[model samples]
Target: MRIYLYILAGLSSALIGWNIGQFFLTDIGLFKEFPEVTLFPCIAISLACGMVMNEIFISNPTRPKLSWRIAKTPLLIAVGLGTLAGLISGGISQILFLPQIRFPTPIVRIIGWLLIGASVGLAEGLTWRWHSMEAGDPKRFWQRFKVSVLGASTASLFAAAIFELIRTTLGAMPAEFKGVEDPLGFSILGLLLGLTFSITNSPSYLGALRAGTGFEYTGENYEDIDPNLQPVNKSSPCIDKSILKFVNNGDAYEIEEGLSIQLPGTGTVRIGSAVKKANIYIPGLPLHVADLELKNRDAILKPNRVAFNCIEVNGERLTSGDDIRRLKHNYVLTFYSEKKDGIKEPKIYRFVYYNRFLDPQA
Candidate 1:
């Protein structure tokens, strides 16, 4: 299952990278003469990045010789993965898009595939390994994912802005399009587009940012989120392997920092800590309890409207009608009570989880 997920992620990343590359290439006029080279690299990079995304984000011990061997395996696999992704993406683009778009010949296509895979592998591997996404909790999975995407997309947008600026200086970009080609304009536009791709694809660049920087998104869709908002760190869902076994609470309940929860007809819950957040996840629910309420200090709890849908952190709330604003490293959560008929006192349950750095780094 894990291996398959990695492959799927790699394929999607390749497609997104190719599409983003094509968008830029078209603006730069590379679409006309060297269309082949323009997109191949993007596909290759995305796949390569995807191939190693798991190792990149999850905690693992560093052994030089072992690391080398693992690294080699992904690189070797990337060749094939890149080729497959490129061909599929290119074919889909040609079939569905404008007639003016050109598809590389069979031989050229294969060569392009190889190059793209190699380049994407190198770029993604280096970046993801160096900077990985951290998963504070399941509630934070998507939030961190978006943050990672934003980081990579920001990088991509910056690159495009620089390119446009250079072109303007060289008078390569026409004066008529000058307004359209303004660095700020290009950057804004590229940022939106890159964000769209990142969200849809969940590439390692975005994932890496989430892990390394502790960034995340609380918004529904990344493109709709404010650029001025603070950046989110991409987080991985999997706990570090070395620590995973020890921290095993047998899946009772879990929560992380900077999260808030609201329970229907009850109250609110918020949880966060100083220095670092806790890793929170819930296993089985007690049979007696029907639902629960979680809210922050200031939130007004409504009745029968909100059901405990697990956990919420910072600005990302889980249940419907739950609202989140900003993500803070520090947070608090209040778990509400559900009582049955004839029961006077609300039955409370205990939540268990692992705290900061219980196990040594792998």
Candidate 2:
């Protein structure tokens, strides 16, 4: 697909250049006497077409590698359709309203037709601006509309200038258009065009400026959003693997700083810690409940001062009854609930840490 577009883009450009430079700039009758002189222009036009197509056609073609490939089907289509449309428009204007539409040189008139056509075609799709036009508010829509125009104009300027530059380098450009023949002018124009393309395509610099917040990929349609208003880091939605398993329910919920979950049973089995309230507090649960909190990548289990003597880990009773302790992986925690039938067999829970560094199935 790209190769086909490249060929078409190159051919359209070459036709526009050949007509303007060879037929209009020099005598057609002297071609046999001066074939050598015109050969350079022919080569220049070919090179120009190739260069333009390579720059505009391929996906990510702007990289420094020599681009025999490109993605500029739109440009080629535009030049062809735009030229034909312009020719028709010009013919109609000449016949009905404007007598001044005629040019002395037929080749010159044809070249004009192609150039105008190319501009129209290029302008139509080159700038993604429908969203800007459909923007809900008038002020913002106008802003985007202006940006669209600027972007299209910038691309067209580069295309027209580069096309002429290639022709001039081949010594095929006519004297009338030689005023823009300066290398410095071409260089500046190229730099500006490159800058515009880069600025528009890049998501960080301009996206940050436009969004005015931490970057987020908030939408699905790229065309609906301005190119300059998206994040460089496109994020995808996924489940957080860092989680704490609920032993009683078999539910795995994500673990984060200040996280808390309640395990429901005879009493609330609170998971996670707090200073004022237990994460799992049931006033009537006969067992003294402590909060199990995951913080700083560590699980903290602490008992209230009044329930200090009630906590036990891995079948060993906790000696430091009032202090917080780390809940290690695979360790068993037992809680004894005081009841009318006296202290019964304690309910048991095991601690398991879901390691994020481990691979899948680890």
Best by TM-score: 1
Q: lDDT (0-100) at residue 278 of candidate 1?
A: 20
lDDT of 2 by residue, 1-362 (tens): 54444434444544544444445336655444433234223323332333334434343345433222222443454445444544453443334333464543334423432333334323333422221111332443455445534653555456555655565575665676665443333233333333443333221111000111111334463334653343233231111122222221223222212222222212222432222233332222333456555443455676656654556666677666567776554444544443436646543332323311111111
- Please report the TM-score between candidate 1 and the true structure: 0.29
TM per candidate comes to 0.29, 0.26
**How many clashes in candidate 1?**
50
Residue 181 accuracy (lDDT) in model 2: 40
Question: Which parts of model 2 have CA positions greater than 4 angstroms off?
Answer: 1-21, 24-72, 81-148, 154-362
Per-residue lDDT of 16-102 in model 1, one digit per residue for the tens?
665667686877666554454446545554545554544443334455445454455455555555555555545554453444655
lDDT of each: 0.37, 0.37
